[model samples]
Target: MLKKYILFFALIYILTGCGTDYMLSSFYLRKDFTWPTSPSEQKSLNYYKHVDGDLTKFNGYTSPSILATPANYLLVIYEIRDIPIYTKVYGVDGSSDMGVYVAISKNAETFSATPIRVGGIADDYGSPVSFVKGNRVVVLATGGIGFGNGKADEITKISVSISTNNGYNWTAWTNVIDTNIFKPLLAKANRFYTNPGNGTVLVNGTLVCMIDYKANGADTTPAGAAIIYSTDNGITWQLGSTLTYSGHRWARVIAERTDGKLLIAAVPNTTRNVDNIYNSNGALAWYMADSLNGNISSFQPSGLPNNSGGSIAGDRIQYSENGRSKSGILLLHSTPNRDYKNPGAGGATGKVKNAMSMSISSDEGQTWTLITNAIGQQEPYDKTSFRQSMKVLKDGSIVTCIEEGDKNVINDTSNQPFFIVYKRMGLSALSDGKYSYEGL
Candidate 1:
């Protein structure tokens, strides 16, 4: 009877709040958690694992994403040379491409960048996200979708490469989605949008991937975060139905919850672009899909930036905890500040660009309680940090990899960087201000 009562109370404590420290009323507010006191304390909250802290013009790391391997390894795929899309490359006026690099770490503490080139065309192929089934490791990347004229040839086909011997070597190019699949879809559409930052997940014995495109011939017709999935080890794929959402802006991240539901997050602001980093409307809108091929729920606001109402900071990360006793979903996202024009009213309002935070959901993703200050205060109002990836180790320790760049004060605005940084901490460490990093 005593044991039963104890378990009941513990359940209540967890449901009421992840202990009393994370007690939140709206899940969109970041008022309760303990924040870092000083710059030193904030530094303690986020330290580095791998990075030289150099800042060059187009040389620093930009979009960093991660995946877990079969043998408990963290496979990180990010763009080297760290150049942005649709820029000059190799002295060409309109040539821009980045080399895709993969790093494998067995313990998530130490990492080594492999020499193998994950899928990439000479034109543009970066941002490779991985998925594993048994011993097979499949890497899915882009062929560079062009904009600002008629330069959308790369978006015609979805390129893929597979490896059975871990992160050693990759196979040749395999077009998962041929030109017939996407070319016809985009032929009629006047304004089309597609970025290389795609996401994938194995759902109900089928591998599902998210690709956003709108071919309604007008911007008025809401663009959809469409789906393309493979069931046979990525050897063959099908162009599934379009999953609709709130405001289909930029690339999205898809994560499966512990309850077997999938949440796809996208940038909801269509009027804004990269030129103006942070404007008035800056937040991530999410939609829950029963299946990638099934009907998607209506669009709604997410609890990402907390009360700060910050912009969609970077690529949002989602992970349902490992093991049989799956608790809930852990969503790691970022934002610059609540109100960029006017400072500090609510929604994590401050001048902290690329500022990171987390939202925990127990009942799938129906509601989220924001845990503010996971890696907070990147800078005073500039871009402190952006584009991060996380790995939930077998031992329940979640470690995140971050980029410290020109905006983050890694180096001055002159030199770029090739290295990214990782910090060692769990969810509780975010509120406690435990900023210390060890292990390369």
Candidate 2:
């Protein structure tokens, strides 16, 4: 009987060691630091606009969309060489044929000028979505829809380009999945994710690419969009059996968790009565999906019950809240305002403003908690000044690309969009609770 008791005690000890918080002491050190309110209150924000580049030049264009990889590298995609050259006005000389360009920055502030053009034909690439898996840098470009004098009758194809040399160079353009599968109206959308090699148990080690496809025959709603997944490293794809919502307009990003689940941040077109007739609306919903063996079993219900009035414009997901995890998944989304038609607000159409927000899930995305709200001030007056991208800093404070225009600052007067008109904010201020260093 004594031997049996001893064996039971040993088993208890082993179970305690396997608890989730078992390595908490070693991975995170608890510390007390006053959370900053504004950008100036935090020392980490000093890196904002610190890079000495010509913001007024096409080389350093502003308002470019950004994405960060698990390797802590920042990928910024924008029109290269000339910004004004791409801005077309009614099919005249509106700079519409500008090619998609990419730049890399290891430090998130000071970027290196290793620009790589991602399209073959003239002005074939625009509005790119990028992510990194293993040693490969994958980029998805929306084929010529908005460029040149193109009508809505034109069908847009989804083109893909990859960079194995870490943004140094790219392979020739390959039409991975022809957009014509949907028929009549096909457009290229944003964002894709893949699981870390050999980490997840559910997905069958296949590189999945979730794409946004609109069925124009189905009410012209963005929520009517459907998701498609690729199994063979984007070589072949199979459309998922589900639709995001009734009129889902845009899909900004799709992130796969360590447990083989997928999280997609999408925009539904229900907020404004005006349908996304021309596909110019921002995001409005952050949808989460649970996949088993590369097939989606369940997803967030229609209308996104958790999504508040704030629309999830564009965002990404991280495993560890502080960057300590090699696996697992945590959702990071940006919420600008709803662009529903508000009369006398400025123009005849109601405008959507930008604000930063976040959400977290501990159980591989089964349920989520709204951990943070808008980090920056409200831009009720100006629409341009707002947060664009969210970046997790080395110190755990979430850094975002704060552009001038909405409520903070004015857009750079230079003919070229001012690149330096960006800033960062601490994540703690955005968090609902006090800043906890336990996870850092």
Candidate 3:
């Protein structure tokens, strides 16, 4: 009876602003600190792990979406999990009380230790994507769907919440992107599950973001992604034609090129122990299209280097130096470096998600070169880094939040315990002496 009462009160605490009194400090680098000259040296500096500062408050954190607002503040939205709360609220096997929380930072270095929770609908499968336009920041999270009765079902709907003054407070959760748009493709109800991409890009005056959907429940194949856009500041959303490939594709990352083209990067929808046929070459799939509509069925293999098993994030930046006379479109993507299919020597041990690398393209993602092999400081094969999101700041610095955990349970998707690791460096630092950032 005592234990039961203790659990009840603990649930109440979490549901009603649990981290209000928490003051978790992050390890921040000095503003004037001299950055390293080599790419290897830059990758090893300024990495900080963040949670509620205590495992008891939040057990795990994953699916981080990092955004750089025009006001120069860095905002991150990620999924927070507490086992007891999840088991009770969700009442499903391997359930965890899942919620989307936003952490704010003035500079990339220091952050708000106590994060503000973005109220969710179902509060499960909270993979959030956030973007900013001026002071109005919008976050779209994957919720209002249930995975119970020993199977996953429901036409996954995205919950939209907005904050007028940055991310201090958010409005009530509302559904966006009508379900009728997907009715033609679904054979029956709950046949498709949708997850928001890493970030959204504002093109001209419209807001565009990628939404990846896959066959849910008993179905195993026939998955695709779409481009959803809004002109009235996220009041209403319209979906583009379905972008399908040969095999299942999801976890897309979108960016706007200097030429005003939309670049969508996606990966195969497969997990550990599943046969990975789509990513046999260790690269992310790419689709270059217009912001509004285009034939996305012609997605080809992106030469961008990656581990090819997890989510990826990227953005586009323009480079122009007055004296040097260098100008071009710069595309950057960050993902795990391991190739699951070609895990040499020790097989699975050689393919752990320990190293998160950043790949850069000078000619609008036509060709990419591996720039930095490590973004966050993690021991190879000892710590696991998975599911990362990044945004290039107005000052030309790149910031990322990595989902990392103990490598012992790398195969375990749930209850493995994870932390959101933050890292940032100038584009020049990550690129060595090759390129320097003038602005975004």
Candidate 4:
């Protein structure tokens, strides 16, 4: 029996170099394996003030985006509050100072000792999305003046920065899409703004990025997603179409299908309070866009749970399997499985959730099934895992980076610090051998 098992393992290793890893992972999953945490230095850090006027330090990371290249994996995160107090407590104007940083890894497991600062501002409203072709890498983020401070006439736009050398250094931030084009739309609303999204998908020689658009500063519900396109490999950009609705749409993400259709997923939030907008959105809204530009009618509720978490969808990847070529496009999603909104326990605002989950869909967003929980499903609520981004690598492996609350680093009962967690595994390993593919 021992020799038979050895021969079976050897045959798998001979068939695929990573096959043994997946088989072992599958066995471990049956045993309920514990996923490891990220390196200590990669966690985020910020300061908070106590009632007695003492300043204290905390650790946390948020809004992580990941990109895959031939030689390395790049992870971008909104890390470290450079300011003294929390944004929800004092406000967005003079209180919170968030910085954007990028960490590079030759292998997805180990990353740079210290991440390099990319872009950030006093009032950064959205996460960053990255695109890469050859040596040129582009990152787009939401930038504006005095956002969430309840001030009027505030301008918010999607800002872009380019790194010619693989995310090691980035240029000064500039608006990717000009707000002037939306002047007609802005005329109808008080403070028209755009926030960059989780990911972008390429279709028919164009890169389309789905962003959240707000008609006005005072409006409770968002104006739905605004599609932005780039025909020149993310060098230049323009606005395509703005999808509007009566309900609230938050944290919208997009991906392309094998048949050239685009799948958009957003957080369907019904909460009226501005403070709870980001805190709770129990379900995901799915929209099938027939084209890259328009034709999306309405987003229906998906089978995913009401996790109150920001959902991120990955771009599709075409791969071969069982010796066949160009088999299918694989799409992946990351979100917490349960609603994570509590008044004063989880994080600083107590608005986030834990138990980051990964779901897979091979049928172009038609159906989704949970593959695995990247973070432990039973972790404490304060051990938050939220706002993660994923990518399918050229090596048939999937890489992701998640923002998790550092349990040891506390800001207070209401809020906690966060850190970035980097994870990479073979798709077969992640699915417990349910899915496997050959790199194209």
lDDT of 4 by residue, 122-167 (tens): 3453356667766667777655532343556655556777788777
The number of clashing residue pairs in model 2 is: 19
The true-versus-predicted C-alpha distance at residue 362 of model 4, in Å, is 2.4
Q: What lDDT tens digits, residue by residue, belong to model 3 across residues 160-276?
A: 788887688888778774667655545433433344335565656677776655555533343566667777777677776567655445545456667777767765545324224
Output the better candidate (1/3) by lDDT. Answer: 3
Which should have the higher lDDT, number 3 or number 4?
A: 3
Could you tell me every candidate's TM-score relative to the true structure?
A: 0.66, 0.56, 0.73, 0.70
Please, what is the whole-model Cα lDDT of each candidate in the order they appear? 0.49, 0.42, 0.58, 0.53
By TM-score, who's the top model here? 3
Q: Please give the ranking of all candidate structures by lDDT, highest first, separated by commas.
A: 3, 4, 1, 2
Q: Candidate 2: global Cα-lDDT?
A: 0.42
lDDT of 2 by residue, 238-350 (tens): 55544455445344334565554566555444332211211133434455555522343335423123222212332223333454542323344444453433345554444
Q: Report model 1's TM-score to 2 decimal places.
A: 0.66
Q: What's the true lDDT of residue 69 in model 3?
A: 59
